[model samples]
Target: MNRRLLALVAAAAVLWPAAPAQAGPATPKAPIPVDTYLRQALDGTGLPGLSAVVTHGDEVVHAAGYGHDSTGAPVTARTPMRVASVSKSFTAMAVMTLVDAGKVALDEPVAEQLPEFRMADPRAARVTVRQLLDQTSGLADGGVGIPAAEATGSPAEYVAALRSGHLAAEPGTAWAYCNANYEIAARLVEVAGGAGFGQYVRMHVFEPLGMTGSSVGGAAADGHISLFGAWVARPELRAFGARGGAGGVVTDADDMGRWLITQTGHGPQLVRPESLAAMHAPSKVRDYAMGWGPSDVDGSRLLVHAGNLFTYTAVEAIDPATGYGYAVMTNSAGLYDDTYEVLRGLVALTRGAEPPPAGGQRQLIELVLGLVALASVGLAVLGVLRPSRRRWRLIPPVLPALVFVSYPQWVSILMNGRTVTWAQVTYFAAPLTVTLAVAALSGLVVAAAHLRSIASAR
Candidate 1:
């Protein structure tokens, strides 16, 4: 018996080391500091007030506001900014939730749901909710003049425009990012939820997500637009009359981050994991599914979308595998859309992987691409200006390469500053923008000369 006991004790001692090895090392949760780099980047670009939120897994480790409300008041996480097209993702998800609840069918035709809504092509009656989400509804870009107005019209007008819209492609055939498609989908939501689309999302999505400051489509209160400092005078409350599913929702970064947490199925009573998976699922008509666009980032699937509504811009992105995501809002639309890519690169870096430099800082690269585009026109101009030996061909193509790069110098400045509400740079930056105008004019001159030579030779 003594000999057996000694043998068992020896066996236990040998296995102890192996047990810890099997469990693996603990992953260190490093504190992700919000740097002045972001603030400087925004400042360097002369953006109005900006807000950013970053979350890893289920925890939002960073949420900060820079600049003031449009009224020279300090902006907080609760201070709302127009999320622009980011509203589409919420609308898409809300519609899908109704589908999951058996209140709406994904394959059902919009005409059937709302008979008052008819398409110019009677065959458009065959357009399904899935087709609209995938951007394959065969709808023309808003028609010449009247159609453009109708396309940008209110919800009722949007549906009326759809009925009057001619099919540019067959359903489920080509990709056309049509706002009307989403507007119709929002109508379906209205039909499905048996309430106004905005009201439904407010109760079902915003409140449940703990988005106290967020309002759906229309403002729950007046004064939606807030200005920061004297950087730009108080931007008035942007009209929310459209309330379409495409680019009409208002929420701050704080509420957006909370909603983003649910993208990974972390928030309360949010959409189910299965539902979220469906939103990310790729469609035959587009690489995008529902309200999200997908791309591989650092070897992981990242779902991303940006919203543009007049002067306000917003973006939301996440890596589903890592549950790492970011949301950024700026007062001016398209002012520094590329800056968001820099922020994305920072998130990638935090994940322990290296990302290339911020593309917005690469003035040389931008100049090269711009010149190349102008060169095509320049070639045509050369034929006219100097009678080139080449044929008089005009080929002008614009390439909007979505490259993500972060310059530490600029980023350090954007992130280090406090919420300073009185610093003004718009006046100086407005004149500095002349540099871009000069470059553009130079390119045009070269292109014109080439074209003139070509014409003279002909």
Candidate 2:
């Protein structure tokens, strides 16, 4: 895929919530064909591996794994995978637990709890616990210094990095999804709860929810597949120690089912109903709650969260009204939205309807773009070898080359003023991006040579 298409897909994968559709009446005991649809989706999407689980109350209606991991190991419900921003929900719950204990208040200034939490912008002093969980603290993604800090830096150092950055808007005035908000919130948990952020989560959240296999700071699953069906391993976010609250929970599908059950008001009552309700309610921004987005799926108002860490993607959703929930995880990197596709298919099956065919047009478009880039490189070389007196002939190859070289800047502009890194471009769409880069550089070389030939002839 070209960079523009890739950016659009990436944005949709991360930013957009699934649209609400009218769902059929909930059956007290409905049998969903999760396994049948998941297997077909695995084949259709070209994913290397996936794990999924559907839950109703405390019962696991369906749980299964398809395909193999990077090591050629067979996938199972027990296979661990990175859940990315799904971790945000876990962090938000941890904070709520402290609130229930009267150890922290949602509306209190975060700097009061974690004294080191300061930003270069004075408006940051007014940032509160609620704003942090709701992603309205004004510390936009691109400016957060966590991207530059030690991947294993302490929470204090993470806060210091954030302190050096400026806010994108006044606190509580606008909504911006910033990881720094969670990092600071996690730091508050460390200070108030008097334990390491990960340890605190393990004790208060994972342990209580009976999620024994879950933990924070684990590496992303190894066998992440690219859109072109090539195996690519994404580097573990070394800074997970600092940003664990934002996107770092690692767990298997079975544990995820249990977690989902709790969220849907079934399973163990680890958290009080009122507290969970608060987390699920929309914050000042109508689009996002604490860590979840309220979306309507098949007539059910489902609280959903989808996560992408470039290497692995995950989606967890619950319909409290129906006491049903599901979670899906994939070992792949790109803008394919595999998690959403699988979840939607399963949800449709539960409603006794067939989902439309999985979309593969994006992948096909990318393949065509890759071939076009190669063809441009070949034509550029040919033009250099046999210079055309008609300089206008240079426009075709030269124009695309210029566009390709300047594409990153365009992407940065589109991504809420965040700078695009070479590593990010390579991770999101490696095959097409690399080909474009090579084609652009080669085309420039040929253009230079062709211009020299014209000048020499004169």
TM-score winner: 2
lDDT scores for all predictions? 0.59, 0.75
lDDT tens string, model 1, 70-160?
5666656766777666777888888888988988778888777777778657768888888877667776453312234333545565576
Q: How high a TM-score does candidate 1 get?
A: 0.67
Candidate 2: stretches off by over 4 Å: 1-6, 10-32, 150-152, 219-221, 237-243, 298-300, 390-407
Candidate 2 lDDT (Cα, whole model)? 0.75
Residue-level error in angstroms, candidate 2, position 40: 0.8
TM-score of each: 0.67, 0.89
Q: How accurate locally is residue 184 in candidate 1, as Cα lDDT from 0 to 100?
A: 78
- For model 2 the TM-score comes to 0.89
Compose the digit string of candidate 2's lDDT tens values, residues 20-41: 6859765454443677678888
Ten contiguous residues minimizing lDDT sum, candidate 2: 1-10
